[model samples]
Target: MVNWQFWKRRTPARILRLRPRGELSDAVRVEFPELAPDVRTYLGQAAYLQLGYFETLTRLIRATPDLAEKEALSLAAGAALRKHLALLAEIREEDADPAELMEPFREPLDAFRRATVGARPRETMLTVHITAGLLDDFYLALASGYGERGRRVARILRADNDRRQLAELLTETIRGDEEWRALLSLWARRLVGDTLLVARGALLLDGDGRGEAARAVEPVFTALMAAHARRMDALGLAS
Candidate 1:
C-alpha cells in the first residue's frame, strides 16, 4: 500500500525550495531584455512547473485502470508534453541551459507526484485539470507584463479545451452519487488547498524584491478560487 500521508507531510519542505534565488543570469537577462528580471524569473519558474505537470499527468494516465479514461488522459498528456517542450525550446533559443533552469523546481514537482500517488483516477484527473487552470491564469497574468514572445509562450501553454474535457468528465462522474459527490468534494478542496499553498509560497519567494510581481499575482489566485467554487457547484459538491 502506498503511504500517501507521508508524501503530504513532506510537501511543505519541498515547496520552500521554490523561493527565488534573486538576480537573473546574464544569459537570461540578455534573452529577455525587454522584460523585468522578476518577470523573467517568474516565466522560467512557470515553465518548469508546466513541464512537471505533464510528467505527473503521464504517471496518472499509467496508473489509471480504466482504458477509456486513460486514453483521454493520454491525449491531454501528449498535448501538454508537446507544449512544454515547445516552451523549453524557446528558452533554449535564448542560450539558457534548460536543465539548470528547471533543476530547482524538480523537488516540489516530485513531492506533488508522491503526495497524490494513490489517489483515485477521478481525483487525479480533477487535480490535474484544476491545477492547469490555475497555471493558465497565472501565466496569463505574467504574460500581460511582458513582450510578444512572452505572450505567445503563455498562449501556447493554456490547456483550456483539455481542462474542459476533464472537468466535464469529473462532473459526470460525481452526479447523482451522493457518497461520491461528498468524497470528491473533499478531495477537490484538499487538492485546491495544496496547490494554493505552493502557489503562495512561490509568490512570497519572489516577494522580497518584487513586491509588484506579488501583487500582480494576487488576482490570479482569486480567480482560481472562484473558478474552483464554480466547478464544485457544477459537480453538485459543496464549495
Candidate 2:
C-alpha cells in the first residue's frame, strides 16, 4: 500500500516560489486549501488519473485532431476515476458499480464526449469548461485509498521525454490559435498551482524526486492558466 500519509508531510519547495504577478483573488484562495488528510488521500488517486489525461492531451495536441483519440482519453480518465469511487464505496461497504459511480458527472461526460467527437474548436473549449466544473462540483466524492495504481499512471504520463514533448506541444498549441492559447493558459495555471500542494504531500511516497519533478512543472502550469484567464476576461468569456 502506498503510504500517502508519509508523502503528506513534506512542504514542497515550489509553493513559496509561486509569485503570480497579481494576487490570487479571494475566490481563488477559497479554491485552494491546505492539505488535509482527507484531501491528500483523494489526490493520491486524482493526481494519478490527471497525469494520464495530461499525457493524452499532450500527444493529441501534436497529432492531427483525432476526435476518437480525444474521446478515448476522456473515457479512460472517467473510468479510472469511477473505479476509484467504487473502491471507496466497497471499503465503506456501499455497493457501487464503477460505471454507476460516475452518474453525478453524466451531463459533463456527455459534454466531454460531444467535444471529443467532431465538435468545433470553440465547442471543445466548452467541454473543458464542463469537465473542470463537474470535477469541482463533485470533488468531495472522490476516493482516498490505495493510490499506487494511480501513481503508476502518473509515472508513465510524466516521463521525462514525454514531458519535453508535452512542453513543446503546449508551446505550439499556444501559437495555434487565440482561444486555445487562452484556455490552455488558464487551465494550466490553476492545475499547476493546485497540484503543487498535491506533490508536496506525495514527497515521501517515492522519495525519488517525484516532488522535485512536480515543483519543476509548476511554473509552466501557472503561466499558462494565467494567460488564459487574462484572455478570457478580455474576450468576455467569463461571466
Candidate 3:
C-alpha cells in the first residue's frame, strides 16, 4: 500500500543534512523485488525506533553529571545516530517516505519509553545494552532472508561495539554492589520481555504473504533468548 519508490528523484532534507549525497554508500543498491509491503513498513518503523532511542540517550547523557560517564554515553549515542541515519538513507532510496514510515511507530515507541524508564545511570546503561542486543538478534534473524542491500543495512545496525565499552563501565561500577546488580538484572529482564513483544509484532507484520519466511519466528526467538542469556552471563548476572 505504501509507495516503495516515492523518493526516487528527491532526497529528504533530514537525511541530506546528515551526510552528503556523494558520500552515501551504493552498497544499498540491491533490489528486493519480492519483499512484502508490510515487511518494508516494519523495517521503516525499526529505523524510527533507532532514531527515537538515540534522542532519548542524548537527553540522558546531558542529565548525567560525571564527565567520564557522560563522555561514554555521548560516544554511544553518536554512533547509534549515525547507524540509524545510514539505515534510513537505504530505506529512503527504495522510495519510502521517512516521515510517513516513522509515524506508526511514534506512539508505540513513546509508550515503550514511558513503561521502561530507568532511574539511575547504571540502570539506563544496562537497559541500552540489553535493548541493543535484542534488536541486533532480531535484525540478524530477518537479514537471513534479505537481499544484499537489506543485509548490509542489518550489518550496520548490528555493528554496535561502541556501546560495549559503556557496558563494561557499568559492569565495573556495579561490580560488588549486590543490591544494584539485582536491580539491574531485574530491569534487563523486563526490557527483554518488552522488546520481544515489539519484535513479534514486526515479524508477524512481515509474515503476511511469505509463508516460509513467517516460519522463522521460533528460531529467531530461540536465538535471541540464547544471546540474551550470554549477555546476562557476561555482566555476571544469573540467566
Candidate 4:
C-alpha cells in the first residue's frame, strides 16, 4: 500500500500562519469549534490555491497536443483564475496587500502542488480534479467562520469552476483501458491522503485537544470522503 500518510515524510508546516486580522466572530467558535482560521488566513490560502490550480491547468494545456483537450483544460484554468482574482479583490477590501497576504503560504502550497501533481498528463488532470473538488468543498465549509466576509468568500468558492470538462477528459480515458483505470484509481487513493492533510493542516486545532473534540474533525473528514467517493465513481474509478 502506498502510505497515504505521505505528508509525514516532509517537514511539518502550518498552512494558516496568522492570527485573525479582525474578528473571526463568535459564530464559528460556537459552530466549528477550533477549526476556523482567521479571515486573512482564510483569504490568503483560498486565493493562492486557486492561482496554483490555474497555473497547473495552464501548464497542462501547453503539454497537451490535442486541441479539444487543450480547450477543455483552458476553461478549467480560466475558471480558477477568475476565483483567484475575486479573492484578491476581497483581500484589497480588507486593506491588505494581496501579494503580502499570500506570501507566507507560497512555499507550503507550492510544495503541495509538487506533491499532488503527477508524472503523466492524465494523472495530472485527475490530480486537479480530485484535489480541487475536495479542497473547494472543504474551504466552502469553513467559510462561515468570518461572518459576512466569509459569506462573500463562500460565494466566490461556489462559482462555476468548469472542472467538469476535466472530469469528462478523465472519464473517457479511464473507460477505454483497464490499465489506465487501475493506475488512476491507485493515484487517486494516494492523493486523498495528501489532499486531506492539507485541509487538516489549515485548520486551527487546540494544542492538546482530544477525545470528542478531536473527533469533531470526523464529521468534516467523513463529508470530504463522501464527496471524494462521488468524484471517483464519476470517473468509474474505485475510491
Per-prediction TM-score: 0.72, 0.29, 0.77, 0.86
State the lDDT of candidate 4 residue by residue for 1-239, as single tens digits. 22222222233222211112111212222234555556776788899999999999999999999999999999999999999999999999999999998987788888889988999999999999999988887887777556778779888988899987789989999999999999999999998888887887776444543556447766666666776787788789989
> Worst 10-residue stretch by lDDT in candidate 4?
16-25
Give the Cα lDDT of each candidate: 0.58, 0.37, 0.63, 0.78
Candidate 1 has its poorest 10 consecutive residues by lDDT at 14-23
lDDT of 1 at 11: 20
Query: What CA RMSD would you report for each candidate?
Result: 9.5, 13.7, 9.2, 6.7
Per-residue lDDT for 40 in model 2? 33
Worst 10 residues of 2 by lDDT: 137-146
Worst 10 residues of 3 by lDDT: 12-21
In candidate 1, what are the lDDT values of residues 26-90, reduced to their tens digit?
12111111222343355466677777668777887777787877777777777777777777876
Give me the candidate number with maximum TM-score: 4
Model 1 lDDT vs. the true structure?
0.58
- Candidate 3 lDDT over 1-239, as tens digits, reads 11123222222111000111121222222212222224456467667767866876888888889888888888888887887788788778778787777776777777767666688867777777887677655654455454666567666766654776787787786697889888887888778778777665553224242465445345446556766787888888865
Candidate 3: misplaced stretches above 4 Å? 1-39, 205-216
Off by over 4 Å in 4: 1-30, 207-211
Rank by TM-score (best first): 4, 3, 1, 2
After TM-score superposition, the amount by which residue 130's alpha carbon in candidate 2 deviates from its true location, in angstroms, is: 9.4
